[model samples]
Target: MSTDQSQGGGFPAQQQEPPGLTEEMRPQPDHGEKSYVGHGRLEGQVALVTGGDSGIGRAVAIAYAREGADVAFTYLPEEEPDAEETANLVRNAGRTPLPMALDLCDRAACDRAVEQTVEGLGALDILVNNAGYQMARDHSLEELDDERIDRTFKTNLYALLWLSRAAVPHLRKRPGCIINNTSIQAYEPSTTLLDYAATKAAINNFTVNLAAQVGQDGIRVNAVAPGPIWTPLQPATQEPEKIEKFGDDTPLGRAGQPAEVAPAFVFLASPADASYVSGTVLGVTGGKPVF
Candidate 1:
């Protein structure tokens, strides 16, 4: 099983509503269901992954389980089926799985996610703020409405803050870490996804600053900024034309798959591997630059 697989990028035109499902995507993304052999790097740890029902979240949850971590994850109510599948994968790997149907835009829900993960899984060692939101537009200035901006920021940025704040005390005790899911769109902003891009750039700032503040307490903070990856988010949010070309802009000449990006999270969360690594962004960008 390899961590990095070239997906050959282009996809047949498809569409779905917000918070898309894994089953609906054609050529269904490989969430490391068969690939990603782990070496017990995260043994005995417990992790809370926002939006773990599918895409990078599912892949990360699967990787964490295989690495021996008990996992709890959050998803939209509409994403229940996808969440169940992710839960089954964790069980198959001999770990606990807690799936919560949640809309993370609520501050209370963010706090609850951490509390439940600790109570259910026994402890919280890794927190992956991987849930995000974005929508493609034909005219960014004309069509980007207040509601769209608010939802994008609330989901992508505000929830990250709420969750991390709630998780800090618990993490300090275990000397655990936080890994926010950032994006290539941060550095290379998309004209259409203005709100989403802004939040990602803010996340980069937040990740580094939080790492510094938490380091004294033995808590590490970092982020992973992925380039165009073939996750359900593409079809659900992007314009058809954009989805058709997808990751071709990358030097790799194709978009990446969820499986290919999971290892970066595992590496960042691994104490033996990343104990001294903090306040940095790991790029799984298919030849795109994160810096």
Candidate 2:
């Protein structure tokens, strides 16, 4: 990372194919490889993070393990390398790591992921719906076809519903919680990301409604709406030109690192810290307004 780019928003203009890999990114993303210190906020808990193979999911998985929680994360079959790296990080934190290759588009796969987490880890305390998809610079609505639209909804919204439905029963047993990964696009809605933005808005609605429906059962539901964090999602989804200034528009003047967002997941998953926090969107988006 250059000092000039260290300022946050002045990225050196980069790009990658859809579903980019962390290792290939310029200025490798900082997933708290050494700096995140945990104080047992989630001691003895178990977590299932979708997209845990890289980016924000990897950060959350690493943080959860350090905080004394066993972690089970899902990734695409092609993301095995990333998954292995994340598993190593979790193990180094003195916690168990169950990395599974899965396709979230399949409803059955979503159900099985939840089952595997509880069955393999002994219990389920947290579920992080962090996996998503988006195609950048699809300027015209006409350019957005049925396949892209379906894929966007299935990956971002449908899988969330499927996973949440499957995990809710287990969560009710432990009185656990669900944390969703939403985006600033939900409220801001860039024309280029029409479908992605719509799904995020739907996630926000689902989070609030589900929180209300399940509150009496002692299972909380919430979301994190990040503005512009430098992750695989950016290079994978945005145009090369756009990638150069990826998060420069934020008030903070730069994109946030994955490590910076991990703490928010920890805080929300911690009963000691957020017992009364539910149906809320925690913004980690530099300076963008989530509300």
Each model's lDDT comes to 0.92, 0.91
Clashes of each: 0, 5
Q: Which stretches of candidate 2 lie over 4 Å from their true place?
A: 1-5
> Model 1: how far is 252 from its true place, Å?
0.6
Score every model by TM-score: 0.98, 0.97
Tell me the tens digit of each residue's lDDT in model 1 across 1-291.
Answer: 574454666788888988788888987998899887889999999999999999999999999999999999999998989999999999999999999988899999999999999988889999999999998844657788888888999999999999999999999899899999999999999888788889999999999999989899999899999999889999998777777788888898998989988999999999999999999999999888998
True-vs-predicted CA distance for residue 197, candidate 1, Å: 0.5
Best candidate per lDDT, number? 1
Candidate 1 residue-wise lDDT at 182: 99
Residue range 220-269, candidate 2, lDDT tens digits: 89999988887888888888889888788888888888888899999999
